[model samples]
Target chain A: MNKIFETPLYAYSRSPDQESEVAVRHKIVIVGAGPIGLAAAIDLAQNDIPVVVLDDNDKVSSGSRAICFAKRPLEILDRLGCGDAMVDKGVEWDLGKVFFKEREIYQFNFLAETGSKRPAFINLQQYYFEEYLVARVRELQAEGKAIEIRGGNKVSAIGVHDDHVVLEIDTSEGPYNIETDWLIACDGANSTTRQMMGMDFGGRVFEDHFLVADVIMEADFPTERWFWFDPPFNRGQSALLHKQPDNVWRIDFQLGWDIDREEELKPENIDKHLRAMLGAEVEYELEWSSIYTFQCRRMEQFHKGRVIFAGDAAHQVSPFGARGANSGIQDTDNLIWKLKLVLEGSAPESLLDSYDYERIHGADENIVNSTRSTDFITPNSEMSRVLRDAVLDLAEEHDFARPLVNSGRLSVPCTYDDSPLNTADGLDGPEISRPGSTCPDAPFGDGFLLNELGDKFVLLTIDADAPELVEEDGIAVTRLEISAKDDTSGAIRRRYLGNEPTAVYLIRPDQHVAARRPNYNENLMRAAIRRATGKE
Target chain B: MSDLILTTNIDHADDFYAALLGAHEGLSKADSDALNARLVLILANHIGDNDILSKAIDAAKSSG
Candidate 1:
């Protein structure tokens, strides 16, 4: 990292003070037209907020950076109405296979759970996702909404004042000045905006680097994730084959720490590795090959004054568990609503500060989990190598150890504790009963589901005889209607209510149960609503 | 996403302190409480859950 970037005062993506009359003002200005930035633009614009999306790129890039989109991000995409299109184009996968020395050791089928039309995971190209989102942004703009997209516009200077931010944008025609109420930096890991804000991105870069290549293959392979540990083809190397949309495959090879960088990116080098791994006389054409170094780091703060950070600009984790892009999209999901609230005058500007509060914590947690996974996948020390080997060996005898063999570091759905929104009932014990945990998806009624009830406030009443609570305009309460006599969705009743005197379990939009009351607690319920909406 | 609410290891109180008030950086209880109040009001607006949102506001003010 550059020393200038290390300083909190550094500003690299500064807007240039250029001369042009194409000046426009918006309620918000978003830099970098990536998926997260585009999502924010579409969301705010659809909500009738004036937004300008600036991107230096003229066209969508080829290949997928983030191949797998988890359910949470999918929900956010659904909110923007862009998810359905992506869902149609993407391939859904629920099963993954792990191999040890050419023998399949264990397999995980995510569809083991009931009550979901959609699969647990989807594989889609990042470019296609962006392409679809950009179209949606244009669609919103055509309806006379306030959305201005400035392509090939390089921001030269960013002048932040008391109330608004002024940007010096250099467009294809000339330099122009654009001002906005708020500025969001969705620039990548080497973020110019994050550097400009002078926030320190803290973490270590691993010594080893991996080669990633996407290629078209002639041979047919199982529609499953194939991973190898300690392969003999390339001594001390691990390889993976992931099925893509077409007959193409995304392959990743862990080249030891000391491989020649220039030589490794060559097609012949990739061909040699592929030939050895495949062991078949198959014709393949390499599409893209690059060396990616893993760095696990997060910014100290996600916000500084009116300028805020999101996505890679905030944190960059290794590609382990497919967390990099997934987490960035999550940052968008968390920030967009808060920014919308602040912009709409529903909450104080201090509410904007929580953007940093929650997302920085989220990024920090991702870095920790991702770093641990990276360590397991590519153990650096001798002790780690031996330990990893031992665990894989244990999988041969123990079914419990199978996940370890598969490098299955489950992605944690983040929950917040002590959040300003947490209620007393939310603070229950046993760690697993923590207030801000990720709400689990389970079967509800016939063909109905639990996670499907998200995207809105859900008040689940367990007490059938409890007095009627007035239905608020925005909040929706569903009586689980479960008692000793009820056995429909039998396991769900046993799981959440659990013989406790739980009456009403209030779940938030993010699917987390906010407060569980044994009976109707009007005061607590009202207070919880106020906290969730900033109406108090 | 699965419908099972998977709780993390951290508790709500500690998460609030670390995430919102910068408790890990040595924020005073009074300041944390004040932040807690401000955040409760703000987050109430963000949450779609009315009952919980209202409860959050009460908890914030009463904490102060």
Candidate 2:
């Protein structure tokens, strides 16, 4: 890492900034140095686009906030060059045990089938996650990539122009204005940019507040998601326990709405709850404790003129599903490539609307899942409680009802089923990576299918010669011709080739399937490419 | 997803109805109310379906 990023926190000395000089312009400026902003910055930087990131705070988040990192976000992070480090640092687990009162109902496994690179989910502190991302950015920057992280610089105001966005940034010395071709607002849930624009952020709030406590203790608890509903220790409420790195345990107790926040967070009160949950003799030191009332809300559109919103700035949801930071990272994964293409003028500006459409749909999916988990855990009415208890009781005996056991329905990547960018799936290929879905990873000759694909449009032809294809816009062609023995051994034919003699799949810059043909067809590929880039 | 599915999901609707009405026949107002609450819970547990339970709640809350 460069000296500029060697220290994660601290106010930076001012460079010869263009405060009064003619407003300095950049290709793109990202607000907030959280996971989403840093992820987007890395995405753009990988595309060789110059990016500047502004953060109000120095260093990463304080505690193990947003501990659960889902596989989808891990995959996205892997592309940006920090996935392995996170996995190494995180505690990986997929099993979850749901308890009703004293007896255990059932245990569920997420992504039980294996051979995938990343696990279903990993528990890591938010600060470490951001630290890895910032480190990745530094690695890219050291490689002569154009990226800058200005810690302690906050966006004072945002002004949208017809073709550019002007942002006034506040620093210790003074404030300066910088214009960008586009501004990505990843300033998180309390986004100043969204408030400045006065956008309508609408959704429901889960009134039940939750006490989050991170305890640094070595306990003989299994590395699995353990959730208790109406347990004797918690009376009529719910509790969750998760394992993070550094032998720290992330504990959550659902306290219903209408309680004094101060009283709830008092050390004595926290000590009582901890003693009840972990027994009296468990030795531990309090790492962190806080209370939060979550919400499942989102903006109507992610993009407004040259300014765009990503991550928590655009949407929010309860912490139940581990969707908050993971979805935000996915938001950048969906936005950066499209923004890059639009910036390079290879794609029309209308291409960015697909980001809003696909991502709003994605956000809505998270909100719906979070809302469901919230309701299931905390019943809204007496009837609701009765109904939930019935299901839980039934789950103990009947296998059919076990599926209804909702313990924060784990996060997964949302497929863009109705994306305008997708051509209908008519081939016999696997549904896992159909059109408008994340590109499935399979062992190619030596590397993975995803590794072969670049950060640009590709024409993937399995077991065939390179097509005499017309490369549209800046789309690059990487012709892959795998041998038959390796094909079956790698599960490549099973996942992608199917029974087709020659299969062709058109992929977009964001690694989403745009279209696929049973056989090579240049005209079909060209049309799909045009539609994908908003050129049609 | 739930409609007031009236296609006789239960095996013996007539028998269940007879018992339901008979259970409330000779009870005072408070006892009848308690019986109704307990009955609702029992049947709800037996049903074991949120969609159906929610529909039943809605139907009971609404006046014909």
Candidate 3:
């Protein structure tokens, strides 16, 4: 083993090592050891770039918030070598039931029509998920990757001079100075870095407060998502129940804005709510519980000088659609690739700007959608509740109301309509044909699926009719043909192009459509690749 | 002020990446803007010196 790997710190000094403190700048500095920051470190360090992670947190929080993982983030976890562990530990759920006044209103099976190795979503506590990520970071460090993790180190100040970012870091011992080429602040919604930079965080903090509890149950219950609306005892209250591993279930109660924060968090109060939801017959012990308020807000900018933000640092969405952490991870996914390209000299620094462009749109979209969901689920006004209940009643039986009953909005991926990398037919296409939307799965050659075509840029053309475009200089492309009637191909055609596209379509590595043409031409095709990759 | 697009409309490869930078300028998310600039400078430092990006930072200060 290398001397550096054997000893991460240059020396174990009681006082700050003065000689070793000669502005030892790293290629990148990451703030916060959360999923987004850690993912950024893993990707950058793997590519041989020097990285240092800073966090004020001495230990991972035991808070069991954010209990769901969507498909896109699973792909990212797969890339970082933690996907298998996540899948093993997480409970896959494709079926969810919505209840209105103690009756099932409508049910939807996520696995009903699609076939893929990745389910629609999985349920797992965020803290355990963090442990899995930390393990991967440790493995990478053992291999002499230039990734450094420093916990309990508060970033006291941030100053971006034209040449580098100078950070004032407070350690257990004393305050010290660390210089970095660039900084990423994944420090979360209450980002001290953002505040230091003097950026505006504009949004509304809703009047409603929710009590989230992770409980260990003694009674047997079906493994399904049980969401209740307007229960009898807690008038104008709602509850969310999902089974976690080890006979534990995460439950949430909509305890309107008026309750005392401390009293509501008490174990007795939490147990009372759980028993009320589960009925007194079902005995349970409390594992963990916290009272949190939901907010619909976003930062004015994700980037300022050498410091960038991701996850909660960038935006905070109410947790209705499970967009908070998932969206942040997507930001990491979007930024990491561009950062890699810039570090490797394959792309310019400007490429990093798209991270802000792409992800902010995602956060904005999430806030709007999730806020709407919060309103529908927990209507503030009596008239609105009456209207909602009436709608739920209609949703139970009327076939016409079924689709309306299922807003089908939560599962819908946020569209990046404004991405500079977006093509003319980009995110604007119908959900199926949307270029900037998640690439739909379809059968390609000899039974290999379209999603199998993920992991690299793919240019698919329906026409075996058009001659293959010569592979461009720095882009990946593929072309194939299948009859419209082919089942797998039919599904793909239905999902993506609405109908099978006549010409050519290019998909980005993240599975969003980059470009499409009515007919395939080498120059036009190459142009699309250049545009998406920012060569033009 | 509006949604940030991840894909570019430009057909040329060079222009597509250029659009990525250009689009970031129009981003509305507060965190997205600050983080985007930070990533650009950080990535730029990995490639070259702190000259251009540093100048941009200085310019931002004057404008603010």
Q: Local error of candidate 1 at A334, Å?
A: 1.4
lDDT of 1 by residue, A279-367 (tens): 75868877667888889888878887788888888889888777777778877766776677677665577866666776777777787
Model 3: native contacts recovered, as a fraction: 0.00
Lowest lDDT block of 10, candidate 2 chain A = A1-10
Candidate 1 error regions (>4 Å): A1-23, A142-144, A406-410, A426-434, A442-496, A500-502, A505-511, A533-536, B1-64
Higher-ranked by TM-score: 2 or 3: 2
Q: Write the per-residue lDDT of candidate 3 for residues A1-536, one digit (tens) a residue.
A: 32211222212233232246475676789999877888788777766778888887645546667778887787667767787788899988877888877677777666634644466788887776777787788888899887777876789998888757988887767778878878999998898988888888899787898888888876676777877777665667887888876677988888998899999888878777876777888767777888888898888777766678889988998888788778887887777767766666666677667777888888877876776667667665544454456556655654333443323245355667757777687322246556576665544555435445545567666543555444665454665544445645366556644543554678766667777665666777777777777676
Q: Can you tell me which runs of candidate 2 are displaced by over 4 Å? A: A1-10, A18-20, A499-501, B1-64
Report the number of the highest-lDDT candidate.
Answer: 2
Which candidate gets the maximum TM-score versus the true structure? 2
Give per-residue lDDT, candidate 3, residue A178: 77
- CA lDDT of A210 in candidate 1? 81
lDDT (0-100) at residue B16 of candidate 2?
A: 44
Interface Cα RMSD per model, in Å?
A: 17.9, 13.6, 21.1
True contacts kept of 1: 0.00
